[model samples]
Target: MRWAACAAGVGLALVPMTGSAQAQEELEEVQEARRTLLMAMPGTPVSSIWGLVGQLGIGVEHAVGSYVALVGSVQVSGALQGTESLLPGGSGSSGQTWGVGVDPGVHFYLTGRAPEGLWVGPHLELATYHWTVQNEYLMGRPDVPLSEGDLVTVETRSRTVQYGGSVRVGYTAILAPGLTFQVGAGLTALSSRNTNFGTPRVEGGGAATDVEGQQLLGSGFGPNNIRNWSVSPRMTLGVGWAF
Candidate 1:
């Protein structure tokens, strides 16, 4: 009877120890799941196809905690100038357009943890664009005599800046051990300003004033010259590796 009693005591003592060990294992698993540190993804906006422009972007997410992450993106765009039709009586028009932008945000995971599953966050956007064009046209100088060979070559340059904020909701899926795919959408409220810079130079004819040169180059080359505010929809698609 004493031997049986000692055996029961040993078994009973081990029951708690086994439970404690299992609890510890489960805790370790939770810690492991939350240990994700960083994820980098190259992505682009779905609407980038508009206006025949091409954009390249890289997105990064850094886990700050179990449910929160810091996210950012750097983007660049390029396109052939599309302002020939808008220029007044201008020919041989050629130009290039380009832009750079950055988006910074914080993501709060509603499901799973940082850098994975579904998440929502608020983000800020900042961007700048530049356009340069050279074209030949008659210099509209009222005081100057007109001639068939009096055409002037004018070069115009313009720039624009935009800033805004938006809230985004996205889903990130782990396709393989370290591969990730993400999609997101948001509505952004943006404020923009455009400016004509670097006085346009005139060659081969009568002198051209800066204002006249800008007008000849056309306003459609960039954003409106006035301060403007608008709301626009934004989207993102990306594939990357997550460590």
Candidate 2:
């Protein structure tokens, strides 16, 4: 009877120890499964380090599962513009442009893990831009063909709003704990509307002062242009941080 009582005591004592060990193992497993949210910045601020050009943006990534994540970003940028003379001798017609844009995007991670290592994903983006174009003519100039005086002969202006959306496949590599680089290419569909002003306004085939507000590859895309629907190629390269 004493031996049986001692055996019972040993078994009862081990019951609590077995439960404690299982509880510790479960706690460690939970800790290993937990993931941290990551925040990042992409754009000229980050790419400037590599002597590359990039847009400004704030991005975030959250792991929904061990292998999948959700990502999103918001971006704003200024448009580049320049003046070009269309007529003769630098005294003819000239055009100037100004613009600003905003972009927002969402993505789903499909490779490796969220906010770390190598990842490839599909994403969608919406972009909007507001732009202005001004047309000015030189008056009474000897180099110009038909000028009244060396003054403002004619002035016309136009404003445009462009909106676009794109679906892209992107890849990112996290080289270090808080650093990453990305590249993406896609096709975009865009639409634009324009508002014109001034005396000699820009119209098709009959305007003297032509105001053009489109550009591509760092130069003019064409003459006074706003398209209802268009498709174009888009590409991006950037460096960023995940923290």
Candidate 3:
């Protein structure tokens, strides 16, 4: 009877140990699943190669639920312009442009949990840009003597605001424990409004239309006071660390 009782005591003691061990294993498994990622985008270099607008940015993704993740990014972009005047003896023109933007979206995983596998989502974007153009014109007759006011300088400035959205489909791969790579494709639609500031004057003291100024300086040199809508395709590639 004593031997049988000792056997029972051993079994009871092992039962609690086994249960504790199982709980610890489950906790470790949960810890191994990554829920957040930090990413760096190579979008700017690719876009520059394609002669398209490009952005430099940092992004983040966080799994909020089993099947959903939230993603966001901040970006900055810029372009430079130089053109020769359309008229003879016109010196030339130059422009400086810059912009900033933000993008935010939600991901719905189809084949796996949040931040993994294949996903589709909708994203929104907001951006603003500023442009400045400087030009010089030769107003005096080539055969006659020149005066101090014979050379005229003109400056034009404008601001533009854009808002848009896109629908994207992508796949994210966890290459290693904490390394991830992602690729995505999408269609984007955007609407923008531009406001031109300051009046442009030529040598004859006559004011020039914004369109004419833009053309004479350089076609598409600066933003105009028009509302425009456009649709385009977008591609993205990123490498990140997951935690």
Candidate 4:
């Protein structure tokens, strides 16, 4: 009876080993079968990264069939714009900014697959732009030539950051496989919430400008040009890649 009990225990242990070997063999067979299938096909490279994709991508890829693909892309930009006074360039009339910006947005397409060609879609863009204050300076001396007796020297500085959203309708121009160009502009709005006007050191005071009623001191992305509910015309251009 003792020997029979010992044999039963040994058989139970061997059953798990046998099952494990069978499972490993089945796994190997599935892999080699995939390789054999790849070899039988013409001109397609086999990749090790195919297994996870086969299991997951077929369910989520829009190109495969009806699926909701989560698509995302980045917008790289360095835009330039010139402006006129009513800003913060002291008494200067015009200025410019090397506007740097970044925009990111998403779109949902009503299609059963990753559709191609002139497709119009609605998009919302969140963008941030920075304008370096153009230090508008007084050429030589004051226009009135304050005589050297009543000269007032002033030092000032300014900068601006603008953030806003836009609703755009555009066609994605496919230049090639996986590459696209986006160009469109319908409706746009912007508001720069912060605007500052200051003179760091207004030396020799008493030099007063006899001008008033909304005089733009300089042009940049700062105050006066933009405040709450300030509306300006806008344009949009972008490029991206899809993988």
Task: Indicate which candidate wins on TM-score.
Answer: 3
Tens digits of per-residue lDDT, candidate 3, 1-243, equal 999999999999999999999999986575447888789875432122114556788889999997899999877888786777565555677777778888899999997777888999999988887777777755444465434224555777777888999999999887656788988999989898888877764443234333344455565345557798888897878888988
lDDT value, residue 137 of candidate 4: 33
lDDT of 2 by residue, 121-182 (tens): 54554544343444343433345545342323333566666676777666766553446676
Better of 1 and 4 by lDDT: 1
Ranking by TM-score: 3, 1, 2, 4
Please provide the root mean square deviation of candidate 1 (C-alpha atoms, Å). 6.7
Give lDDT per model, in order.
Answer: 0.72, 0.51, 0.75, 0.36
Which pairs in model 3 have colliding backbones? none
Taking the candidates one at a time, how many backbone clashes does each contain? Answer: 0, 2, 0, 4
Provide the TM-score for each candidate, comma-separated: 0.69, 0.52, 0.70, 0.40
Residue lDDT tens for model 1, 1-243: 999999999999999999999999986565455434334444343222124456788888778887888888888877765434344454456778788899899989999867778999999999887877777665555675433335667777877788989988999776445677888898899898878788766666544444565565564345437587888787877777766
Total backbone collisions, model 4: 4
Worst 10 residues of 3 by lDDT: 42-51
